[model samples]
Target: MPTTASMTRRLAIALTSVVAIFWFVALGLGVYVMQDEFTEIFDSGVQETAERLLIIVANNEARDASGRPVEAAVLAPALNSQYLTYQVRDSNGMVLYADGAQEPFAVPLSAGFSQTATHRIYTAATTDGTLFVQVADALDHRSEALMEGGTALLLPLLLLIPGSIAAIIFVVRGTLSPVAQLRDEIHTKDGGNLAPIDESALPKELRAIARSVNSLLARLKSALEAEREFTSNSAHELRTPIAGALAQTQRLLSEVPPAFHQRTAQIERALLHLGRLAEKLLQMSRAEAGIGISDERADLLPVLMVVVQDLERSPLGASRLNVKVEDGTALERSVRADAFAIVLRNLIENALIHSPPQSPVDVHIDINGIRVTNDSALIEPDVLVNLTKRFTRGPTEASGSGLGLAIVKRLVEQMHGQLLIASPARGMTQGFEVEIRL
Candidate 1:
């Protein structure tokens, strides 16, 4: 079977994916904005350095030309490596002085900012425009700063995404827990259990569903009760008339002429079959009424013994039944005595009727459950599957109402037990078996 997708998992995954995508988009936008800001700040620094250097270089050159002493501190070379490199050039574009520059920048000397592939350049000049100072900031330094800023913003997401996923799953599972509970409660409703769901604890959205389900269950329970009552009453009303009719037919068989005896016997047989069918209907009604479950536990061994003994007294059961009880076996269970007896009677009677003449019906009892087996041709798989259905029978000439297994199956389920029907019973090659586990 294919696996089903969970609502909680699907919701969590969708939510997490959306959150991650938006987070990535926001991070990209943030990085873009930060890059622009960094460029502006670097440009300002480059322009400021060019203007300052132009003042100092122009003042020193004027002092040198006037033969006046220039302040050494103002013209001192930078002791540390600077991010900005500069070249001082005269109007003819000849280099006068340079700081942190291996070679003059390959660009025109003009005032204002310009950019080359490698650097951001800003130029400043004296009042006469006789000299110019061009400041160059390496492009790689700005790129490195932007990369570090982006990394700082991105690293937290590694932890945040997984943590968010975990939190999302947790919240999704919690939010859907009520739905799971409602499903379980609805699943418990059946013929044997039609109890209404408690709507008090449910959310507003699901309370309407619970109320609708409860209404349906109420109608169903009423209909089933009416059906069971009619079957039970009709069966009870039929038993006396059927028995009387069978007795009268048997008397008529004795009184009738030899030529009429065959027809009278046929009538007797028909009445007998009708009586058995009525009894089965009664049993089915009781099973449908959910009489198998009991609050009080009882020793089921005595009930089992009584049913087997009663069946043993019958001519068909006499000398054709074998009973085996495991040592130290205990049948203390919560199933009602009458219901358990009906189940046992049906299974044993079914086995006895279907088995060939002189074939022994074996009944095995243990702590776990009970098993009934009988010698017969192996039942077909398709036919075996439908054996517990009402009026369904196998390919057999034996007389049966076909409600025995159906009744037993109903009672077993009401008792919260499992009934398994199998061909080639256990280790035997040609037999049928009914095993019940309670």
Candidate 2:
């Protein structure tokens, strides 16, 4: 499963992209509107300057030295300049006055504003015959102004994108904090701790989740309690009858002759297997109840040595178990004694039953975990897959009730540990190995 940050990061990126796209579109529309308005203003400014020049020409009534009208240069600011350029021609197509840039404009004695290829031209007529006053401004000036205005409009949004991304990350993380809290709370929970969550301080969206989790915890707690009670009671009742039956069978065997000893031994084996099965059931019940899930730690090396000793004293156990430890006291600091005992006992017992006759079982303990190796024929892969299942027995002369591996697996899970079964141990290809990590 992906973390909340990864999931929300994609959402934030999508949101940021939406906002950025909107900014791009809005900026484009704004630039278009601004450019349109600027064109109107520029054209109006040119027209106003031309009208002013016309009024000046009309008011001054051109003359030379005497009271006679004649062609003359216009005012100081009106000739050959970048801002306002003008040309006036008479009805006869002769230049009466020209006060603008050095290049002359082609005119046909027309009137009003007209545009040429390179300039915006405004021509006007006086009261006299089709006389013209032409004012021109270049097209490149308008394009440059539009570009500058568009850049000004886009610059702010371009700069704001980085800040927007940062804000999005901050907001997304803050919004998902409650989810992180919920996950941490659930992660620490186990079978032993089924307490209800306090949803009062949580946000409304997460309160429902907290309540649902609390409901599940309450159900699990009840189920575990009921299961433990049933298993404990049933095991106790069966063990009493089973022990009495075994005693009776032993007494009957003594009374019978040597010819019936084989039949009595078969009966004794069945009773013993049943007793072992009942004991394993009780251990499984305690494991499910999390009876010893506490801080009390057990050093696995010494525990392994004790298990070896106990197995040697038992009839169904291997004759000898060779124990080896990397460090003796170095592994003393550990926890979950009950779980370690359950898994170790079952693994060692199972190994003893399957190991070749007179071959010593190997028990190796390290700082991390323990590995129990026994010399035995390899089990098939398909069959090995089901070895941990309940009532699954291996094909061997010395048989078992088949709940050993299953019980070990359950107890190991309760202790927050791992149980791994391997055939042929690591190097060789003829033995079996059971490894447990705490």
Candidate 3:
């Protein structure tokens, strides 16, 4: 029952969250890879500076002891901006010279040339008897650089979050506009309206949805028509029994006849009316349900003949009735028809009730279709449209329940056939027409 907009918005949010997680993971990996390069560059710069300094000291003129051998003041300035520590130590551990004003710096020695697991330590022995070691605190330096770069990228994305959300809201609303219109249209629609949704403004992706909705609406329209007809039929069929009971009651009330006589007469008349109504309704129900109809192919003309003849023997069919089958018509050729007999019966019965007494009813059958036309004035054109609806009746005439024509329509449609009604307008030439495919 959730609206389309809500569903779309949720999906957008979920996708955004996934993208954010992926971005974070990628950022972490990028920083890790770049960290190694930063360390390598820093180490190479320090080593080159150390090697240059060693060459300078080994090439310095070896003046007499009184001349101050390579004064520490001269060397101190050269090592000022570099990450190196140097010391000249004798074989007996006596410090001959050093860079800073302290004892020889304690340089942790490893077994051989190996990169210490620690962030910053590199050592090498110079030919001039000087120990050159480079020391740098790269862990803290790298942490600061990563923080700065991450902030720059993260700040922009954080700002974009609101825009992304707003975009999702806008897109969701725009994408669902047709559905909203459909909702409002349906909201105002009443039982009398069953028109389909218009899809001219819909996007291609949403066209399928609109088509589905239209199909559902079409089905609802048919169902509503059937329901209205059913109600009309019930009311029409109930009238006779109600009128009979009222008449019997009036007679008993006017004259104080014997108790048994009045009571028995009223009960019998009521029971008769009820029985007839029930029988007709049952027949209509069975026919509409397509019960007992076989799938075997049968000639439509022969079926119509049998039903018309049977109706002629009944009281309703005593009027002038005729059956005509087009000889050698292509419609007589065997077709796929399982409910031929029921179809014929319903059409004939409907024509008999509608036509006036002594008026001829024409039953025509051909290869393509069968049509029943009565001599009576046709029901109005609009009324014909709803004739197939359950419980519907003609505007002026009300005899049997209106379910008969409805049953015929349902049966015909179920067989993938069609039903059509046509008659002349506003003249004595008007007559009921019913057509059904084989």
Best by lDDT: 1
RMSD of each: 3.9, 4.7, 15.5
- Candidate 1, residues 174-195, lDDT tens digits: the string is 9988999999999877765677
Those runs of model 1 whose alpha carbons end farther than 4 Å from true positions after fitting are: 1-4, 67-82, 99-108, 198-215, 277-306, 318-339, 356-360, 376-396, 406-416, 421-431
TM-score of each: 0.82, 0.76, 0.50
How well does candidate 2 score on lDDT at residue 391? 83
Q: In angstroms, give how far residue 336 of model 2 lies from its true place.
A: 4.3
Candidates by lDDT, descending order? 1, 2, 3
**Candidate 1: which pairs clash?**
none
Q: Write candidate 3's Cα lDDT for 283-377 as tens digits.
A: 56645443322324455555556667778888878755766667777544333243466567777777776777667777767767877787666
Error of 1 at 145 (Å): 1.7
For model 2, the superposed segments whose C-alpha errors exceed 4 Å read 1-7, 55-61, 64-86, 91-119, 127-130, 192-212, 256-264, 277-309, 324-336, 377-395, 413-416, 420-430
Q: Which prediction has more favorable TM-score, 1 or 3?
A: 1
- In model 1, the Cα lDDT at residue 10 comes to 87
By TM-score, the candidates rank as 1, 2, 3
lDDT of 3: 0.61
lDDT of candidate 2 over 194-258, digit per residue (tens)? 66787987899999999999999899889877876887788789899999999999999999999
lDDT of each model, Cα atoms only?
0.88, 0.77, 0.61
